[model samples]
Target: MRKFWQKNRKTSLAFLVAALLIAILWFFFWPLNRVVEAPGEAVNIQPMVKIQGKQPLKQNEFMITAVSIAPARPVSYVHRLFDPHIDIQKTNDVTGGQNNADFNNVQKVYMQSAINNAITVGFQHANRPVTKQYHGVYILNVFPQSDFKNRLRPADLIESINGQQLTKSTEYVNYIKSLPKNAPLKIMFKRDGRQMMVSGHKHDIVKGFNGIGITMIDDMTIKTDPKAHIDPGQIGGPSGGLMFALQVYSQLTQQRYQLKKIAGTGTITSDGQVGEIGGVDKKIIAAHKSGAQVFFCPYVKPTKTNLALEPGHQTNYQVAKATAKKYAPGMKVVPVTSFDQALNYLKTHQ
Candidate 1:
C-alpha cells in the first residue's frame, strides 16, 4: 500500500499544478483576450431610410395601418443575453398597471387588450395572419363631413369597409382607393360589442382620390382577452406600453412580429400617443444587440408625475433624459401628446 501511494504522488502533484495554471490563465489572460475580441462591433451603422420625393402629407387624407395587441411576456433568450439586467418582471408590472385614460401615459393596455382579443378570435377562426402592423404617417386633426360625423371615434374597432372584411387598416385604405368617384361605400365597425354600419361616398381628387372629407389616422388595438384574468384597476399609462402590447399580441396570435425578428420600445396610450419610454440607454443597448431598427418613444411631458411625488417625477425625467442621450441620438424622438400625433406620424412615414 505504501509503495502504491508513493507512485501516485507525482501524478497528483502534476494534476494540481495543471489545475492551478488553468485557473490563473482563466482569471487573467482569458478575460483579457475576451476584452480584446468583444462579441460585436463597437460602431453601429443603421440603414438609411429616405423620405425624399414622397408627396407631402395632406390634412384631409386619411392614413391607416394595422396594429396588434396581446399579453406582455418575458423577453426572448437573445434579449436577456444582451440585457441581462433587464427587469422583465418590473416591465410587466408597469405595463399591467398602465392607464389608458391618461393622455400622457398613452393607453397601451387598452390597445393591447383589444388586439389580443382580436388576434385570438382571428386565429381561432381563420388561422391566417389578419394584420400587418406598421408605423403610419399622415395629417392630424381634420374633421369628417357632417354626414360622416360621429360615425367613427378613436378605439372603434373597424370590422369592414365597402363589403370587404377589413383584416388590416392597409387593406381598408386600398379598398377605398380602388373605389370610383361618387361610389357609395359601407363601413362596418364593432363598438362595445354592438355592430354598426355607416355609408359614405368615395371622392375623386387630382392625386388619385378616395374617401370624402374624413381624415383617418393610424389605428392600432390589442385583441381583447376573455379568459385571462386581469384587474381593471391595475393598468396605468407607460409610454412604451403600446409597442410592448403589440409584440405580445403578435405572439399570442402566432402571427410573430416578423418571427420576433424585430424589437422596439415605445409608450402607448389609450388615446394613441406614442410617448417616450424610460431606460433609453439600457433599452437602446439591448435593442441594438437584439437587432432592432425602430425604437418608439412616447411623447410624455417631462413634468408628469408617476406617484404624485417629487421623487417619482425626478426619476422619470432622469430616465427619459438618459435614454434620449444614449440610444436614439439621430433617431426622431417623436413627441406625441395625443393619438392624432401617433396616427399622423405613421401615415406619412409608412
Candidate 2:
C-alpha cells in the first residue's frame, strides 16, 4: 500500500509540471489580433526642404513627429490595455490589409501630394506668385463616423455647396459653418466619371468640426515657384505640410530673423489653409521631448473620439493643449487655422 501511494504522488507531480510548461509557452508566444500605437521620434523639418538660388534661414528649427504602431503579442496587448499612453485598435481597423509594403507606398504617394500643396501655399503666403487656379477641392479621406461617410468618399471633387460655387476649401467650410449645428448641406461632387449631388446634415463628427467630415486637398494646379524649391527626402505623409509651409514662409519673408524652436503637424492646402491630422497625442509628447519651446497644432477640425472622449472644446488644438499640460508643462501649445495665423503668432509671441 505504501509503494502504491508513492507512485500516485509522483504521477500527479509530473502532470503539474507539464501543465506549467504549456502555460509558460502560451503566455509568451501567442499572437494577438490587435495593433498598438505609441509615441514615435520627432524630426526637424528645416533640413528636409532645399530651396533653389536661395539659402533658407537657419534661425529656427521646425519639426514634426509621428506615432508608431505595430502588431502585438498576447502578453504585450494585454499589458498595453492598462497603459494610458498606448492606443490600440483591431488590426483590420488600422492596417486594412496584411500588405504593409503596399500601405507604405500609399503613404509615400500622399507625402508627395503634401509637398506639392505645401510648396504652393507657402509661396503664396510669402506673396510670391505661383499661378493659383481654382479647380475644385479634393477629398483625401472619409472617416467611418463622419456624416458624409455614406454619401461621399475619398478622391471625390467638390464642385458646389448649396448652389453656391465652391472655389477654395475655405469657401465650402465657411458656408457650412455659417449655418446652425447639424444643418443640412447640399453638395455637388464628381466621383469616378460621374457628377452626383448628395444632401446630408453635418453632425458633431467631432465636437468643434460641425461641417463635412472629409480630409481634403485642392485639385488645382500649382506651378513650381521660380524663386524657391522644396526637397523632402524619404520622409512621407501629409502631416508635415503645415511645418513645411512655415519653413518656406519664414525663410523667404524674414531677413536675418531668429526663430524660437517650434514644432507642429497639419496639412496645407494650395490656398494657405491648414487642415487637421492624426496622432496629435503622440506628437505633443515627442515635441516636448525634443525640447520645443512652443508647438503649433491645427485647429481646423475634430473627430468623434475627440468630441466624445474629451467633453469640452474637442479639436487637434484641444488634444495638443491637454497633452502639453500633462506631458510637458513648460511647453506652450498654440493652435492655428491658417498659415498666416501661425506666422503672426510666431512674430508676436516671441
Best by lDDT: 2
Per-residue accuracy of model 2 over 196-309 as CA lDDT, tens digit each: 998888787776677667766656556655555556676667888888888877766653334557888888776778888778988898888898888888884566655765
What lDDT, from 0 to 1, does candidate 1 have? Answer: 0.41
TM-score of 1: 0.32
* Minimal lDDT window, size 10, model 2: 97-106
Candidate 1 residue lDDT tens string, 1-350:
99899879988999999999887665544421111111121111111111122222222211111122222232232344675334333322333322333221235433344333433333333333333343331212224442455565444556666667655445666777677767887877765569888886766433564465544444443333322211223233232344433322333333322222233345443334444444444544444444443444444454546435433354433553455456545333344454444334544563
Evaluate all candidate structures by whole-model CA lDDT and list the values in order.
0.41, 0.75
Candidate 2 — which residues are off by over 4 angstroms? 1-30, 78-83, 96-102, 131-222, 227-234, 254-259, 300-313
Which 10-residue window in model 1 sums to the lowest lDDT? 41-50
